[model samples]
Target chain A: MPLFSLKKNNVHQTGSGITPIVFSHGFGCDQNMWRFVAPAFEKDFKTVLFDHVGAGGSDLSAYDSVKYGSLDGYADDVVEMGRELDWREVIFVGHSVSAMIGVLASQRAPGMFSKLVLVGPSPRYIDDEGYFGGFTAQQIEELLEGLADNHMGWSAAMAPAIMGNPDRPELAAELTNSFCRTDPAIARAFARTTFMSDNRADLPNVVADTLILQCADDIIASERVGEYVREHIPGSRIVYLKASGHCPNLSAPDEVVRAIRSFV
Target chain B: MKSSGPSVPLSDGGEPNAPAEDLEDLYENAPCGYFSLSSEGLIVKVNQTFCRWTGFSKDELVGRRLRDLLNVGGRIFYETHFAPLLRMQGFFNEVALDVMTAAGEKLPVLANASERRAQNGDVLFTRVTIFPAAERRRYERELADARAAADARNRDLTERWVAEREQGELREQFIAVLGHDLRNPLAAIDAGVRLVLREQPGERIATVARLIQGSTLRMSGLINNLLDFARGRLGGGMAVQLDVSKPLKPTLQQAIDEIRAVVPERVLQMHLEVDVPVAVDHARIAQLFSNLLGNAITHGDPLEPVNVDVATRAGQLTISVANSGPPISPAAMETLFQPFYRGEGKASQQGLGLGLYIASEIAKAHGGRIDVVSHANETCFTFVMPIV
Candidate 1:
């Protein structure tokens, strides 16, 4: 297996009686983001964590622009991670933008994951003429400008705006710090790819039991996207967390854990 | 969703002279189907689109009214609502309507309609445009079905909860009375043993023996009452109707004699105020009298007088049993006649709650209802029934 040393993305094996749970991190962050949730699962579950190519400790040489640009490529990595570890019917929990990609991944490889726990994911960006996406064209252009101007400063300023609220002001800095830690070029490329994509049609064929736990106060991925996700996924359930940050697992991990535990 | 309607021809049953440019447009697409109707309600004119909708030709329907083309049920619905709305609204727009084609399949539509007004502002013709509503109609059906199912489930849950609450109350009351009912006979048995051991004098001996017999009878009667109550629950007496020609006095006498024997020393008296006879179930009448006597004995204060009266009028007989006792509180009176409903705060009383309940059920089965009125020193329970 070419000694698949993915930096801190090392694939360790521990098979307990409890069904395995896998975690996928969103753009601008790595599997370390799920550090709080991973340990809670360590005792009971065979927990697997991996990095998307070009992000986290993933090899910069292994980055392929054409394949990495599509969500299906990361989904492949998730399934391959499960196959390599030899876990069956595992619970795949994904955070932030990687949430919806988890659903698409499950649809691509049938029966690879038992159920999907999507924390925050938007199916489509650049809302159509009739639809209202919280952001205007000017705002998205400003975000791109913020990225181009002082990439680090943009991460600092935009993080609080997208990830946290005044009530949970600490989350703004924490998520921004998480974003600033990422490679700037890789983060910018992932942002462009996610914002430009549309997956409205693909949601219907999603047959996995879906739990969409939307943060009540995420500005970037607002509550309406949560509603759209629920409406598109047939027989899917959705609950709004009272927490006020984009990364709720970090801000209120107990509440997030309670929701996942209650549903499962 | 598009409806195939009739075609248009000129009056006197001839096709109109085609204007070359209008003819060209007609062959391609005109939103409304052209149809002419005779004064007698026959369709005279139709266009290609109307022909496609109704699956009929201009030649076939040159003399049929718009009503004749509609399905039987659709015709009634159109005349009742659609026609009036169209006339009053003056070209109704987006009217939700359903129509049947020649294939007898339903098509949902949003119809925008206008009448071809003449110079005098009277409608000589009508034009309608139908757009398909397949997706919207399907969604509406699903929404309605979900709401209806939820409502039905709620109603069922409410009924089940009420029944469960009633059952629980009945169980508590039944358990409380089970002790006293069984103890009465046991006490009588002890008294019989004491009398036999003591070898008392002649007068003492007879009284003690009568007490033992009366107490044992009350105990056995309680057991029998319990059995009848079980039968009544399964609608045991509904199949049996009262023999209207039967006499009522003997049955009342039998019940009074039995209760009188139970408490020989107590002054329980009967007063027949009316000599008229009644048409009723004799066995149930005996049961009613027996239950009334027991209720008076258990609920009335010690040494108070219990009085029974029977009266009759034109077609109904009214029987009243009054006892000088602790007045039944108003709250207790409300559910007094209910099964297992002893008076409020009277759960400790020494009577099976089933007595009054069984008596009332019997009354109802005999085509009557019974009620009670009470004051501090006087409580009267009355049973009224039609003679016929």
Candidate 2:
């Protein structure tokens, strides 16, 4: 379970009570990621914001290896936030790993949330039996071992690959500095949880109105994985933004927010 | 010596005190080291040749193990790599290892070791050879340096070849574009003449025929200018000269008038600034003037005037053609005098990109140089030739 709270006054509005929205941040990040989209929707909807365990402004004591072992733990946290807020009808928008957790949590609370918008979520990270995920076991092993070896270096290397895309080439430096400021311990733990976790089996159970905004890119998620997500989720829709890299929120923020706003 | 003799005796088998064969002839004088080690690796015997080879007295090394002579790193390598390879091969040949002598000096040497077994198949001793590698090391360094120098020279030659190839291709591309400058208008003339001959045959047609004749002649002159460029490059050191015995005034006037014919109705003002009759190639001088004149007309702003000037000083004939023009970039100025070089993509001027190229070539052929100084709104092209 994650330790976090949605500061009530911090939740401004841009939308009516049609469906109150919750912004769940991706791995290694906090609710501060919704700075751009939150204001755009704050006046109309009751927006709920929170941080995951082992992340920004969250309770460090609540973090446990067993509960947070699978992404299902994060799913429980998002669902609990909806219940606490009394949001009967909710649109849960997530970025990166939180996007997959959103799918799992929405699957759990089928009647609680009306829609799930997954931004840059990759399921089944490793290639199995007869598939290729670009990353070999050696690479995954190196990622885990290297992160443990030097968390700060790993984050520095990875942040640019995710953010410095051709479409939004400027985001890389911002993300590099932002991720560098993150505490190394929390980032390492989060890195282990993000890259090493496999979320393929959870996709089929997601019945919420799912909208996956996968940036047309090479680094973060490939078109194959995006298609895999769309294929697995029964009625999920995918929109491939003509952009590159993993974190299009910082790169293609307007395009991402627009897809969510219009999709609902 | 010891009292015991060989148990497997000679054919006579008698207890005869036959003089023992000289041990020197038997082993000490051999080129390689010969030694016998006990089963526990204690050296029982070694030859004088081995002692001399290792700079050790026989007494110092005869009872010592072979590993003592090897460097620590060499010992590790021998045990790990050499021993394993030797075990598989039975008789190791030329296994290279480093050795530290009694003086503690490192020597690179190749050794061949073999197990000397008895008839009963029990291990007896190992035989080895150590050859000095100083000469081989010297030879290797010499070879490497030579190879490196040769590789560098080859690389430089390859770069020069590529530059020349690209230059040739640039020339071809320029000529192909110049074919448009020399031929496009000529083709228009050809078509015009054919139409006049077939449809409009009369005195009016004669005027059209005259225009065609004029274009054909201009194209012929452009072709001659191109040929002069080829001559400059291909002729290397040898060149044809215009006899200085011919008067300079007449030659300058001929050049000015010829250029005037090309750019008709354009006001060309000239000054015969030379006091003494300067010696120069008449046609070649005119070729230079024509290039400068054409460049001024093409690149100079249409509203601005073209001025021609001539001056002589200290056995040098200086011809200056000044024009009003926009500033040429440093990059363009750097390459402006290069033969057949058009200034970037915008140099689609009427001349066969060879005008300036041939002009420079002509100046070089006559032991002279052409230089240009241009700034915003003004440009002056000067040709300096040594008085023949």
Over B1-388, each residue of candidate 2 has an lDDT whose tens digit, in order, gives: 2212354322455446964344453466566667765544457777776677678887788667665676543442343234433322234555545566777776656566665666654456666666666566456447656866999999999999999988986775575456446666667776766677677668876765755655565566677676556544443432657675776777777766765655566677788777777667687777678778778877877677778888888888898888886877898888787665675435455455777777787788788988889898888889998886
What's the residue-level lDDT of A108 in candidate 2?
Answer: 80
Instruction: Give the fraction of reference interface contacts each candidate recovers.
Output: 0.00, 0.00
The DockQ figures for the candidates are: 0.01, 0.01
* Residue-level lDDT tens digits of model 2 in A39-118: 67766676666678766555667777677777877788777766665667588888878888887888788788888888
The DockQ value obtained for model 1 is 0.01
TM-score of 2: 0.36
lDDT of 1 by residue, A160-198 (tens): 332322332324443333432445566557766665666
Clashes of 2: 11
Per-residue lDDT of B249 in model 2: 70
Quality of candidate 2 docking, DockQ? 0.01
